[model samples]
Target: MTTDFGLKETGYIAPSFAEILDGVEDDYRTRLGDDIALTSNAYLGIFARLMSDASYDLIQQQEQIYYSGFYSTAVNSALDRLAGNISLTRKVDAPSHAEVVITTEGEYLIQAGEKFETEDGLVFDLTEDVITSKQSDGAFQGTGNVECEETGEFTNVPANTITLFANPDEDFISVTNPRPAGGGQDYEDDETFRKRLIMENAARPGPTEPGIKSALMNLNGVKQVGFIDNDKYKTDEYGNPECSVHIYVLGGNDDEIAKTLIDKCAAGITLAGSIVKEAPDATGKLKEVKFDHAQQHNIYVKIDVSINDDWNSDAGVDDIKQAICDEINSLEMGQRVNFTRLYSVTYDVNGVDDATIAIGSTKDKLADQNISIGRSEFAHCDPGDVEVDLIGL
Candidate 1:
C-alpha cells in the first residue's frame, strides 16, 4: 500500500522498499523487545528487507492493474477493447484506390476486373467496365475506378505510374492515372489511435462545428481541415449563402468526406464546397453533400548561410530544406507562417552560425516578409524548390 494519501481518481503513490522496510522493522520492535539486534546487516533485519522488496513489487503491480482499466493509460489489447465501447475500430492496412483513364486508337471496350500495373509492380483492378466513346479526331477514351491489389502505404502510386497493363490488350493504346492515388495506409499505431479515441469521448461527431472537425481529423489520410460558418441574412463575403457551413479539407476520400457531411451536419443546413456527392441518410434517401478540396499553396525557400568548412554542406543543405518544409507542413489550414520561424528552422542544422532567409508563395515573389495563407490553402514545399547557398570558410 501507498504511504502518501490520495484519491483513486487522481493517482496513488506506491511506497518504496525503504519505506516498507522501516514499517516492518517498527512492527517487529513493537512485538519483540527493543533488545533484539535489528540492524540492516543482521539476519533478522535482512529477512525483513526481503519481505519489504516483495511487498513493493506487489503494490506496484496492483497500481498498474488499476490504471489499465482507464483508456488514457491503457496499452495494446486494453486500448483496443476500450475503443470498442465507442464503436471505433483501429485502422489496419487498408488498400488504396484511384481513378484511371484508358485510351485507345480505335473503339475499345474495357471490362470489369481488368488489371493494371505500375512500374514497381503494384497491381490495381478495375471496379467497373467502360466502353470508350470515339472522338471526332479518331481517339477513344473512357474513365473507370480502380482499387489496389495490396493493402499498405506502398500500394499508393503517383500520377501516370500505372502505365503497363497486367493483361496487355493490343487494342488499348495506353492506360494512365490523371492524379496521384491515395487512401492506402499501414496499421495504425497506439499513439494515433489513442488521440482519436480521446476525441470520441469529447466531440463524438454531432451537429456542431467542433464535432465535424473532430470527425474529419480522425479519418485516415486527412491532413488539415478548416471551417467557416455564415449565418447572416444574405450571402457572406466568401460567397457562402446565408445559413451555410463551408469546410475546406486537404486530404481524405471524397466519398468519405461527403458521407461525413451528410451524417454529422444538421438537417436543412446548406453545405458549401467545390465537390459534391450524393449520399444516403438514415432513411436511405439520397442527399447531395458538398465540401471544398483545399488547394496547395507551394512555398519556396531561399537561404544564404555562412558555415564552417568542416560541415558537410551537401548533406546539411538537404537537412535544412527538410526541416523548413516539415515545420511549414505541420501547420494546419488558416495558421500563419511567422517571419521569425525561418531562422529557428535553419539554425537547427549543425555548424550554421548565421542565415538570411526569404520565402514566398511563388518563386518570383520571394521576400523577407511573411505571407498570410488563406483558409482554403495548404502550404507545400518540394526539395527541388528549396534553394540553399552556403559560404564556407
Candidate 2:
C-alpha cells in the first residue's frame, strides 16, 4: 500500500519547499496559481482523500479488487535471476494473436563483444570488455551538463566533446576527465574522482530501471523477466485494443514451472493457462497439453473448433468446420497441432454463455478422468477472439 520513494538519508522529507513560503510573504504568493496552490496544499493533507475516492470508484468499476498493477523489485529481481536468455518473436504460434511475444528472457546472459570488419569479412569476438560511464559534480549528487577544455599537456580543443579514457594510465588522463555525452573521460582532481565514484556506484538497471514497479511476475522461484504491454495498439476501429501484459522467462523447457505460473496468472480470472510443448516436426507448432482442473475437479483436454457467422455465410459454418476439422484431422498422431477448446464462451459478452459446439470427449467422461475446462465466464470481453486458458496442470 505504501509507495517507496527512494531516500538516501534520514534528512529526506517531502522537501516542504512549498510550505516554507506559506506564511512567509504575500509578495511571493503571486507565483502560486489556483491549480498549483491547490495541488501543493492538497499534497500535504487530502492527497490520501483523493486516493481513497479513486480507489473506491475503481473497485466499483471492477477494474481490480485491490490495485495489483504496480509490482515490486523483489519480484523483478527474482525474474531477472531466473531468465537466462533473451529471445523474442512476433508470432509464438499460428493461433496465438498476442501482439508481442517473448519466448524467453532471463535464460541467456549477454556479455561485451567487438565487431570488426576486415577485407576477409566481418569478425566478432566476445573477449573485449564494455563498460558504461557517466559524469557528475562532486558538490552534489546531481550532475548537470559539463564542459571540457584540453590544453598544454592535454589534447586541448574548443567545443570538443568530453571523452572517458579507457586506458587512463597510458595517457596523462586520470578518471577526472569530463567526457562529453557518450564519450569517455579521464580525471585527476578529487572532485572529479568523487563524481566518477558516484556515477560508478549508481545502480545501472536496464530497461525497467530500479526503484520502479517491475512488470515481471515471479513464477514459483523463477522470474518471468520480460513483459509485453499491448494496451497501445490502435485497432481497425481507431480505438486501443484490449490488452494484457504477458510475463515470461527466456530459457529452458521447464514445463512444470511455466504451467505453475500460467495457473497463478489465471486465478479468479477468465484468462486460463495453457501448456505448450515443442513440436519436433514444425517450427511454430507446439503440442497443447491437457492438465488437471483442480478447482473444478475434472480431467480437461484439447478440443476441436469451428467458427460460424451466418452473416458471413459466404464463409459458411460447415465450410469453416470442414476446413478446421480437416486440418486437425490431417495431423499425424503426436505431432504438434493447433489445439483449441470446443465449448469456450466468446470473449465479447461477459457472463453470457454462448455455448459453441464441442467435440472430443464428454464433460462427464472428462470429470471421471479428473480434468475439466476452466470457468467460461469473462469480464471486459473482446469480440470474436476466443481466448482460452491452456496450462499443463
Candidate 3:
C-alpha cells in the first residue's frame, strides 16, 4: 500500500466523516491561511454553538421518550372504569351507605315550649289566648279564656265547655308550618329559624342512622355538631364548660352551597374539589373524570388483579367479599367506603357439625350484581361474635 499522505493526495484514502473532521482540526493554517487564522475565529464559534444547541435538543427529546413509559394507556382505562362506576341514584324510599365527616362541635339545642290542648283534642300554643263562644242572650258573645300566667293553662271555663291547656314544656317542636300573623308568616326566634334551616339545608343522613354529629350537621348551613363527654371537654383554669358548644355555619358567595360550608368550618374541617365535597350519589353526576393521553405521549402499560381465598375454610362468602370490593372501587371519591381494615368471626352450631361453613354458604347465596372484594383480615373470634365490621379509610 502507498503511504497515507500519498494515498490521500490520490483521493484513494478511506475516511469516516468523524475521521475526516478530525484530520481538518490541525489544518487551520492551510484552510484559512496564517493571516486569516490570526484575525478571528467567528465562523468556528458559530458552528460549535449550532452543534451544542442541536445536541441539547436531542437530549431533551430522548428524555421524554424514556419517561413516557410511566404514562400508560391501562392507567387511563382504569381511571375511566373507576369514574364510570362512581355515581348517584335517587330512590323513592330506598336507603344508601354514606360517610359523615364531623367538621365542628354540635350540641343538641333543647327548647322548652308549651303545647296547648283543648278539651275537644284541638291543640294550640299555650302562650296565646283563645275565644270561646256560646248562644248567650241569642247573640254571638265572645267569652275570653284567660291563659294561666304561671302554668300557661286556661282556667274559669264552664264545665264540659271546651278549654285549652298546655300539653307541657317539651324539648322539641315540629315547625313544619309557621303561624300566619297580620299579612304573612315568619319564624320569630332562633329556634324557629333553626327548624327552617333543617328543612331547606339539611340533607339526608345517608344509609347510616342519625348520630348526634350527623343530625346536627344535616341542619341547614350547619357545618357540624356533636356532644362532648366530660373527659374530652376543653377546660379553663378550672374545668367548666369552657368550650362554648361549637357550631359551624357556612357563609360566602352564597350561590354555591358547598362553598358556604367551607367558609364556616374553618377548623376540624376539610374542603377540596367536587371529589371531596360532592355528596354520595348512586346515579347522579360522577365526581371524577378520566381520559387517555397515550397517543399524545407515546406510552404503554399493563395491570393485573386477582382474587383468591380458601373456599373450603369459610371465612366470608366469596360473593359478598367480591361485591364489597367492587362497590368500594367503583366509588368516585375513593374516600367513600371505609375498608382499610376488616374483622370477622366464625361460629359453630352445636347440633350442626359445621356452623361456620353454614354462614359462609349463606353469604355465597346473595346476588352478585355490583360487587368487589376489599382488603380483609381474618381472626379467630368467639362464636356468635361475628358482627359486620366497618372500617373507615
**Highest-scoring model, TM-score:** 1
For model 1, the stretches where C-alpha displacement exceeds 4 angstroms are 1-10, 14-63, 66-72, 117-122, 134-139, 150-167, 178-180, 233-237, 304-319, 345-355, 382-393
lDDT of 2 at 381: 11
Q: Is candidate 1 or candidate 3 better by lDDT?
A: 1
Candidate 3: where is the Cα deviation over 4 Å?
Answer: 1-241, 246-345, 348-393
Q: Could you give candidate 3's per-residue lDDT for residues 58-117 as a string of tens digits?
A: 544544444333222112233233223332111111111111111111222222233434
TM per candidate comes to 0.76, 0.15, 0.15
lDDT on C-alpha atoms for all candidate structures: 0.81, 0.26, 0.27
Scored against the true structure, residue 147 in model 2 reaches a CA lDDT of 19
**Per-candidate total of colliding backbone pairs:** 1, 41, 20
Give the winner by lDDT.
Answer: 1
Q: Residue 19 lDDT in model 3?
A: 38
Residue 316 displacement (Å), model 2: 6.3
By summed lDDT, which 10 consecutive residues of candidate 1 come out lowest? 1-10
Winner of 1 and 3 under TM-score: 1
> For model 3, how many clashes?
20
lDDT tens per residue, model 1, 249-345:
7666667777888888887888887677899888899899888867778889889988865566569988888888888877778777765797998
User: What digit string (tens of lDDT, one per residue) describes model 2 on residues 1-393?
Assistant: 232222336521222223323322232234443343333355523443455445445433332212222121112223222222222111111100001011111222223332211122212122323232323422211112221222111122111222232222221222121211111122223332232223223422122322011211121111113333445433313222334333333211234333433333432221112323223213433333322111111112322333333224343333334343444333322233223422232222232223333332333332212222223211111112222321221
